[model samples]
Target: MFAGSNRLTIDDKGRLAIPARLRAQLADEYGKELAVTLGPECIEIYPAPVFRTMAQQIPKIADRAKRVLVQRLFLGNAVESEIDGQGRIGVPPLLRDMKALGTDVVLVGAYDHFELWSYAQWQANNTEGQTHYADAFAALAVP
Candidate 1:
């Protein structure tokens, strides 16, 4: 039940300290292992077990294009990491480079995983989301 958003800073070495509340939950239930990969517009992080479960659920495909896409884009991009004693998880260089992440970032809890967004990127995404808010809500049938 990861939820809410928090502003954070990436250390010079590209490690981010997970917030205490979420950190405690993860430590108790999942230990320190994590999987990181690039998302559509941000970096995604999932507990290692959670990631494994999700990976297993990815439907098998006979279509060559779909299979290739999944393998190359999702599985190939994933990197395993461990949260350090200080609650910090190091972002993979490839993942960080893809997202153009800098020191200032925001951690957004996206239901099943977390999205790491550079501050500027998050702001731009939020602004664009506003333009589609009506359509998005309508699609969800939310009143």
Candidate 2:
């Protein structure tokens, strides 16, 4: 049900505060534990239960090579983190390095998780993706 985008900053210590609106939901569902990992083009943050469910189901991917690659890169690099008392979670150096996360970021709500994108990369690609929205909508049978 998460359905919004939030522009945020990475503090000098490499942390981003979870937006206030989502804080209580996250707190009730996960307390302070979160799983952070790589997504196709962004870093993803998920509640512990949600991440565990997805990780468990990853073996269902039929292609062995693709599954292993995803397992290695996504799950292997995944880190379990605690939201500090201040509501911030620090993105690890390795995860930040793997993606182009600058100080500026866009945290997008993605139902079970949040996808964090580099502001520069997001700004550069967002407009270009608009042209394909119609195709995407059609593919989803949204018309």
Write the residue-wise lDDT of candidate 2 on 1-143 in tens digits.
56688999999899999987788889877777999999888899998888898899889999999999989988998999988889899898888888979789999889889999999888777888899978887887554
lDDT of prediction 1: 0.88
Candidate 2 backbone collisions, by pair: none
lDDT of 1 at 93: 77
Q: Which tens-of-lDDT digit does each residue in 1-143 have in candidate 1?
A: 78999999999888999999999988888888999887777999999999998777556677878877777877889988898889999998788888999889999999878999999999999998999898888888556
Give per-model TM-scores. Answer: 0.90, 0.91
| RMSD, candidate 1, Å | 1.8
- Roughly what TM-score does model 1 have, to 2 decimal places? 0.90
Least accurate 10 contiguous residues by lDDT in model 1: 54-63
Clash numbers, per candidate: 0, 0
Model 2 gets an lDDT of 0.88
RMSDs, each prediction? 1.8, 1.6
